[model samples]
Target: MTSTDHDTAPADRTAAGTAPAPAAPARRPRRELAAATVGSVVEAYDWTIYGILAPYFAEQLFPGSSPTAKLLAAYLGFALGFLVRPLGSVLIGRLTDTRGRRYGLTLTVSLIAVGSLLLAVVPGYASIGLAAPLLVVAARLVQGLSVGAENPSVAAYVTETAPGRHRYFYSAVSYGGVVLGSALSFIVLSVLLGVFGESGIENGAWRYGFLFGALLGLTALWIRRGAQESAVFTAAAPGADPAPGPDGAPGKPGGTGGTGPAGAKRAKAPSPWPVLRAHLRRLTVVFAITSGATTAFYFVTVDFPSYAEGTGAATKEESSAALLLGMVALLLAMLGGGRVADRFGALPVLRVGFAGLALGTVPLVLAMSSGRVPVQLVPAVLLFLLGLPLAVSNVFAGQLFPPAVRAVAVGLPTAVAISLFGGTFPMLAELLRSAGHNDWVPWWPAITAAAALAASWGVREHPLPGEPHA
Candidate 1:
């Protein structure tokens, strides 16, 4: 029996009247994976809320604002929040290592709750002038900080909790959360549109969406609070915390000392800087490639919707409907993409998706610009193609590093790429069109394809807790 199972063994004595009775079967890894996936989905709902509400906020909070300028500003603020994620990963990763995964997740979820609530009630530009936009910016900052460390903590938790052979399968659920969350956002917005119509959607109805986001976060917090710390974490040496360093040292205070399986502790813990110094080469490679994925995702998901709707080629309602349709297609693709990755490996799947996106980007942009029957179908087609890379990258990125530095590895790379590439993609696209280069819009996807191929080649799938690397 496992150590955990033995802990709960019956006290009945054996024939010698000295030993304890046998223990029950251990709770299987599948069950643990389920819990982790549910938690991830809940967390994603909160993170995606801002993206769904951005257009409306731009209309209300920045009336008469240029759609391009307004969307750019809002995303810039959103990107700013991503900028702080490395800090969150370091802090939360340290906490997870020192205290427990449960503690870190609880803290992150709580912060999301507070940020969502603040956004829901923040006054509009008309009511508070510059202060309104400032408040929205502040709320995003808080949310970014909370979400920054979320991926690392969740990935670490799932990897440790799952059985070896099923590690990839279980981790796929984490990416599934993104699809599920974005799909729900579209559904929710669709319903809101029906209830409020166009004017209502632009009016105060959008604020309620933020409240809804907060509610989802609170629900996630409540559900996760009941989960115990992972056995992987609890098994750390006397004081080994799993907080990730830039390198693989035990993070900050309470990091795992150089403890061996025999339970012997080293004279001193390794410093974070030494760990970082040693691993900079591999780390940079991983970061560069992974960041590209994040940029592609941001370009496709965050900016593209606004670009499509704001193009003046389509009415606001039509654009919203198309966006809603696109997300539905994306959700389905995301769910299926994970299984494909598990079967084929992340690199192949990612390479295919990225290449498809690059080639498809032009057709997709042309369709959006065409304003014809076939062109309208572009959202669904593009969503599916984009969904492929998104699903593979999300699941595999966490697998690139060992537990010691997983959080920092995942969070920082994503933050940097997203901030630089995804954040500016939409603005750049709009600028290109304004500069009389609309024909080059297809190049965006082409660039994404090249980046994806390079990054996929760079990733090294390591041995998981329960299985050998492929």
Candidate 2:
């Protein structure tokens, strides 16, 4: 028996009295993939837009501070937003796990749109004085909460809806959305810089960028409003599915006994704590598995450009160009990671991805630090690409839990790790670079990847605890 099944010695007998649910409709697997991608692109775009525009906004908002201190302050606000993610996970996770994925995802998209709008409209410090930075902090906090809910909801939906054969490829869209989002943002920034010049960008073009995010967030929200509810959760919810019939076949879809009042079953909203408690070890392992990923993504996508520019390794123009290159490589790595996971099993992909990071990150950082376009784009970029663990990570995490607590199960620890590591990535990278230890940058992800490798031994693809061995 699974740990959740066996651990309830004093079982919550409420579900025992309820009937099992009928078979659900054939899952629209592509809809799950599309909805997940659409919603997450907005989440990723909203979050990373800050990192892309940080250098400019830091000047606009925190005018008098030294460049390093300003970056530190901006990242501090970024980190502060992440600090609230655990709370968001608890709240949003419970909502999705209990109410429905559609509810949780829709809420997440709304928050993203609002957060982006806030940043778009909030006045600069020169006009509003102290309130300017405070407003930005508030905006980040909203965006942070949206992100906390977004990743797990997308992963959980993809996992539950996809057929076992194609789960990895579809689930990879979780991170693929991130890659696409950041890529779009960078491309926009490059165009703005080219057309408007630096002063124009800092003054007005940046506002337009956030406005674009706000509009996209609205589009995602509308799309997700119609997202198909999770069939697993639908069947599990109390009233939605009926008990088995006498012949051993289960009741018809949406319960048995026709539409009469006699067939009504109450929907039992799931509680998060017991589910998490039952799977604590798995939860811990999930956290470890994601630590390297969370750190590596933020490190390469968010921190690397600032580090290169700050260290005199590259000019602002060169750093942006290099980031564009790395993002393209990220897209390739995402595809490769998913394909590898589907063919070989997610564990092997996870191991290989982690191994690549552990072995090559230092050299990659060293090469990027030199700022030569060729050196940065060559095989060194491949190492960062390997760090695209979201595909493997999402697939692995999706199969590890049942749908009841899946969102929170995946989101809680992911939030904790990202809050701890991802949030601090830019600050830490900038701090280390400022301290003249540019070489140390690679070791952060290297250490995390090694730890994740050890943790991968504990991951399994089955919904049940031990039926299918890792």
Candidate 3:
């Protein structure tokens, strides 16, 4: 209908008795996108600091364990932390659904900071005995839960705020923040390691990394505290005002509320059982895509260094440097992925990423495993193939469902998928390596890539969910 017709039409209905048209979704501001992505960045920082330093500090925290055993214990802690993420997703997801994205986000960041701070100051095994490892486990679990909630909520918020034409692109941009955080986290790590050297790192200097991560978490909390509530959540949440901020001033562009004068009420948050029953297929798709992204991600960043170092294709220092470069390359690729998705389409770009992973994962793994190739070659492989494809993951998930259950839908599946795959793949790869089954490592990520490919295949290449095609 023309603008004039829309304005001249009856407030509630046409004279012919049709219902009033739905309001068009509003264009969101870039500032909000920046706000939401900072949450993801903080999550990456807090989550990865331990992983980056686990090798050197393993003995200090879990003293008297053999080198391999110590690293294994540290990896166990890392994996266990991720194992608890789904529970966090459920609890924190509910908060976002009931309270508002802003509140949930604010709470999530603070929890992450607390986790980091705890890890930063935990006493060594010599001083605290088993308590050191216990503290490590506790801190990791808290960080894991915070990350579990932070990512989906941030993705939902960004996707809801993004312009229709660039929805997928905006969604993918957060992965860029993830890469930035990874890169920055490593830079902090490398600086500390260089300053303190291996013995010093083993002597408790590793704590600096978590301290840095805590600072990052606090900064993100500040940024997010100023962010407005997600437009989609504000529109969908019932018994709540559309405005997300405490001041009742709107920061995001769109919000919906009760019917005017008629006293007609809108829908409330549906119970979990019905919501779960309603979105089973989409949830499965979310799992598959998340599995692919998380598996590939963990392989490249978390597991690859150990695998490469084990093979002696790269020393520890070389592997760390390679990961830093790979993250930078991935950051550039994420930005590029966003633009490409905007121009071509989200599904197609996602498919391409999956395709790259499916075809390239094994070879890339093999290259790193060979101990024959140059150490730097792995970063180039990461840029072009597996790691690069994951840039579209956030938008890829966000495009599937409406906002009312967006956080839960995205969070739950992601939690399950990552809890199953992302959190465990590195440990699994470690097991495979220890067992001398280096050849088998690639198949784990390859299978997930293929699964993601199939999931993306089922999704129609199109505009944002609920949006009309041009």
Candidate 4:
């Protein structure tokens, strides 16, 4: 057949002939990924600081109460942020799918910055009585909305920018951002507590952590400023009367391919709700497994620090050292995990990671509880290491859907799962111990890891960034 004939041939026919040239290489997409990673890490640093400092914040804000009651209140406030996050995802995900990632991200981070600023200045319970906790809860809700909105945009942006072969590795950076942020919070608190002492932490050092959060939000805004709309998003065709942002400006040009005037509209895919319905079976798998995975990791990273100190497994000093070391390990593991996903694809890496996380969690926690000189540290480091599977899963999650619904696909379900599992995990652990089930706590991670493995198994080995289906 003539060359022209070959171009128009069916897929089977085309395979019999020479294939088309591969698409052009993505241009410095990793730079965009790096910026997104940095912004996310900064935001996480601010958000997680509350979790790390919960014990102190509890003492200061809810004095004259039982220790359990005080800590429980602080955690409940933290969980409140997760509760409102899904609503933010629904609101913002639609905007992201219809508008553009850049606009959605900008709006989200702006809200986070404002919320953190409020938390920094808000009065304690001593000063404001009933209003203090109320305000804290309200501020977290605001923070939740911003956080909910931010993830989907970042997920879409990174997935779109990543090169095909290396996409999973680049995608893993989102989770890496979480790990980095948690590490930073732990290290910073350790230093403040070690140098300034608990008296100092309660008096003013804790406030500094919140102030750092505000600064980080500002930094996220700054880094985001230099980002160009992704090539994939720019490629999407805008529809008529395209959704507008809070400002009068029109949303992003069609995500498919059209950058017109301020009010430009291009043809694009339908909303995510329809797609989600069509793929409910697959979506369920994504949500269930991912939820468990996220819960397990958050349990280890966020809850473990508080648990360690509260349970007397380690001194405040010892807990801080363990956390800091674990953070370093997590950083190394994430970077390495990303690269591994690039080489082997996401599934294989995740399978191994999940199993490791499951088996490792119970033994690790038990060992840490043993209070041996070196073993106490082993569990924290192992916890970070165990999370490698879930981190790898995140990279695949980013690539699971087309750019049009990618944000909603990854963000909404994960948000819901996080809300149910991540938000309430600490409280549940506290309850478990209080109820005389301390030995059973390790089972939580084990169960979660198993669920994650199932999810990893269900995930398609190859995902298309702009393809018609997930």
Candidate 5:
């Protein structure tokens, strides 16, 4: 075959007997990619910082007789953020679908910054009485909304902007930003602990972490403002391109075209509900895919440190150090997995990730229980496994739906699953431990992973129009 023919082969294979695929965009979306990555980092940092610093500030924020009660109240506030995520997903997802990804991203980042600022400055219970905890919860709710909107917007933007052949690799880089952000939180916390001591942290040194996150969010917002809108979104947008006629020719404006006066008479932007309802199975697939990974992720990254400290497997400092190391492992694993998925395919990689989680959980927990393994070792391994599927997970979801409802299709179900599984994980684990059911905690992620593994079998990737198959 000629060079041109060879170049077209992948698209031909994807299209089978259908019309030739559209040409890929000539210019690479480097700026867009960078902006998306930065946004993910800022969003993650702001979201996870609260969890990391909660123990230090919990007593200060809530009036409680015991440390456990105070910590539980703080975690309940964390879960409150998850509870409102679906609303954020719906509101922001619709805005993203109707307005633009750039707009949605900017708005979400702005909210994140505001929430972080609120958390940083809110008066402790000593100064404000009941108002302190109420304000903290309110701030978490705001942050929850931003996070709910941010994930799907970033996923959709990255998926649409990435070069078709290296989409998974690009996704890996985006996910790595999240790991990096989480690691940054740990690093900042560690520094605070070092500078101020644990007693000082409890006395209010934790607010600096949130203040730093707020500044980072502003930086991400500025970066996102300069990003170009996704070409796919542009093409799919009403009136942006002439609608196709019955025979595949471009339809005339205001006639058969789905734009201009006649189309405007019809609808402004397409509603996500109909599309979402039509793709109920795909929505379920998104939920199932997210369930295990999100649960395992929160458990490993957010809860494990406290669990370890409580169990005497590690001190607070040691657990923090281990978590930081685990974040590094996670970042590396995501990048590697993304590359491998690009070379092979996402489904196989996802299967392997879920399977590993399902099979490894029991042993990992047993090792933690036995106290034979180093504290860092188990978390690093667990997070590494979690990162593999997470790297490609959003891209996989983006592939399931058309651009019209892509953000909502991916976001809502994901937010719901996270709220139910991931957001509740830390609080649930603590409660279970208190209730003498600590051993049952490991099975939650294992069971969810098994479900995701089963769901992965039924998922297939479809490249966007004008893109080559990986």
Candidate 6:
């Protein structure tokens, strides 16, 4: 048969033989989206507050001859948190896939809350000696796991629940929550600095930030408790018949089981490892993209402020204010980027963003080093560039896998990438700067951005089952 005839045969036969099932409604559930966004906010707050407050709290928690050593030790603890993220992704991701999105989100938020509370109350080096840093590391480990699972679960939920036409726009909710949470952390830091002064913050006031994060985590948990499960997940649940796609094929299954021709019984759920192995190339694409994007993210949001302060390009208060302003810019950019992605397609938008990063990072870093540009404008511009690709990154990753393996598939590799590149950024940047190789710092993210730009080419857009391809 001719190519056109071959494609049309199935449609013609299905039209002639039986009535096709109506497509699932692409309704936007406000409550569920709100819960996901709130959870994301708390997750970001809990995870980022550590890095923000580390400089103030480092001396108290770590023993070292020099302030730089203490700060490095504290950042090591931060990296330790990222180290366990993959494990969290696997364990919590499995739970998410098996139990449901809402359940996974609630559990992650609870875990992060416990970690935050632990950080708030943990004894310092002066009080507890060796156990102090150990306890801090322990807290980080817990927070890491929660954060590892949290991002992917939230991404999957938002992707599955959103209307296909506006999926990219809705995807902004994930990063928007992150930007808000990061902005809130800076706001809290500014207030604490105002009230207690730098010396007071170093003395003990930093604990309050973690305490506040714990409180916010509890609030997120309450909100998530009321969240509705993703309808796509429900339709794909084991033993539930798959919905019909536009061409009358069986829709993608979630949780477990295999899809076949319409009306065929689904095969039993296979091992996730096999499923993951089958999709290894897709996972690599997620990893490459995440490596570039998250490295840039952590560099701008977590490390750049401290780097500026250390280099005397900006003072503590100045850097803090600049970072806060940058986060606000990022928040706005995320929404705008999502809209642009929806109109132009996510891959093209991602390519453009990463290309900007790959090309512009060095110039921005040089400008910051030169202390010529306004401190606030530099970070705001840098973060705004980062926000564009980040806006729809999680959604793009979510689309790469079927529902049954979406959480773990997206979570595991993304977590690993963050752990390697994003989590290590602060410590690595500090080390380079300390070694007087500060010139090399910008190249790190620039290289990663270039890699992401290349990987974007490999990422084909996969519309949700029953949704029209973009």
TM-score of each: 0.80, 0.86, 0.87, 0.85, 0.88, 0.87
Clashes of each: 9, 3, 0, 14, 0, 0
Candidate 2 steric clashes: 3
Cα lDDT tens digits, model 3, 276-333, are: 7677888888889889888877777777777777776877778878887777667777
Q: Name the lDDT value of residue 376 in candidate 1.
A: 50
Better of 2 and 4 by lDDT: 2
TM-score: which is higher, 1 or 6?
6
How do all the candidates rank in terms of lDDT, highest first?
A: 6, 5, 3, 2, 4, 1
Model 3, residue 354: distance off in Å is 1.5
- Write one digit per residue (lDDT tens) for candidate 4, span 1-470: 12321111111122346664233222456567776787678667877888878877776675446878889899889889999888988888778776677767777887888888888888888788878888888888998987876767787877766556556666677667877887888878877787888888877678788888888888888877666556556445354223332332223554433534344544555756877787666667767766767677677667665567655686656666776777677667777877886776667766777777767777767766776435346545665556566456554666667667777887788788878888888788888878877778668878877787776656467643323323
- Compare the candidates by TM-score and give the number of the best one: 5
* lDDT measured at residue 101 in model 4 versus the true structure, 0 to 100: 75
- The root-mean-square deviation over C-alpha atoms between each candidate and the true structure, in angstroms, is 6.3, 6.6, 4.9, 6.6, 6.4, 6.6
Stretches off by above 4 angstroms in model 2 are: 1-26, 241-270, 367-373, 378-388, 460-470
lDDT for 405 in candidate 2 is 79
Q: What are the per-residue Cα lDDT tens digits for candidate 1 across 271-311?
A: 34455456565566556555555555555555555566555
Say which candidate scores most in lDDT: 6
Candidate 2's TM-score: 0.86
TM-score of 3: 0.87
lDDT of 1: 0.62
lDDT by candidate, in order shown: 0.62, 0.73, 0.73, 0.69, 0.81, 0.81
**Stretches > 4 Å off in candidate 4:** 1-27, 240-251, 254-269, 309-312, 371-373, 463-470
- Model 1, TM vs. native: 0.80
Residue 48, candidate 4: how far off, in angstroms?
1.1
